[model samples]
Target: MNQYVIRPVRGDEWAKVKELRIVALKDPAASVAFLESVAEAEGRSDAFWQARAEGASHGRAARQFVAEGPGGEWAGSVTVLVEESGTTDIFDQHIERAQGHLVGVFVRPEQRGTGLTEGLFQAALEWCWSLEEPALERVRLFVHGENARAAAFYRRFGFEATGNVVPVPADPSAKELEYAFPRP
Candidate 1:
């Protein structure tokens, strides 16, 4: 693919946002790495997409970035959500301090090896590092244990396994490995 522009997703572009997410959920690797399925995303209403985009576009706790192809199609996307101290139930971990959790990372299969993932991470991390006082101390993500390709890429990006593994909620027999990038 040609060089694409990576930028924050606009609040009003929720329809495109929903479309891209459905496409992402259809990828082969989605079964192992992503939580949602294409059918599920496809069934959501316009209101769902509108709310999601609005939350990420302006919410203080999260941000979403998209990579746009030369012809204006969305090539990829990544979202980061801030998990603050005292939150419970999702991941069931008590936060000792503020941290940014990377999630919803998806890139088109054709765009896999073009350094787009790196650029995506740079954009996500820059946003994480831009947080205000009592600033973020680290960024983390959980990868499926069976996804060796993703795990290796995370390592290449400076994230280290924290020796913490959580069972995937959808598949109890599978485990997700947590990796962290300590803030400098």
Candidate 2:
């Protein structure tokens, strides 16, 4: 049997989702690895989290997958948002093709190097490719340039840099590097 049960989070699991997100934000690398600050996340209303959980739980446009450990704890999570062709993404960049953008990736420090990330990415990509209405051309993720560990992991997992660099909104001196994996 698989060591972890990898699955999409149900709407009823909003509390757990919220708790995990808080833990993720407290990680030492959260400054470079995540766009939102811990305070921002904490300030969000419970209603907001509930709605987010419901939306991601039922939509093709977005999904949040979690890796549930043997003890029913969440070890990691990855959220994928589908960007449609001809629309601007959250960053205001024009997207030329429908694709999946991986975000909110977090794995517990203890879970790192245990293949939990691979399991999360596998589930995320599989869901992306399974969509038929707006077939995704590729899956992409941005890594903070300063995050060498994450960048190396993405490369080892088959993502190639697309030569695109965007300045981090929060830190003008830093940049986020784009990496992509084409649909197979």
Number of the top candidate by TM-score? 2
**Residue pairs with backbone atoms closer than 3 Å in model 1 (clashes):** none
**Candidate 2, 1-184: lDDT as tens digits:** 1779999999988898899999999999999899998899899999989988887897788999999978998999999999999999867899999999999999999989999999999999999999997799999999999999999999999999999999898887899999999999
Per-model TM values vs. the true structure: 0.95, 0.97
For residues 25-61, what per-residue lDDT tens digits would candidate 1 score against the true structure? 8888988888778888998999999988988887568
**Every candidate's lDDT:** 0.88, 0.93
Question: Which ten residues in a row are the worst by lDDT in model 1?
Answer: 85-94
lDDT score for candidate 1 against the true structure:
0.88
Q: Over 4 Å off in model 1, which ranges?
A: none
TM-score of 2: 0.97
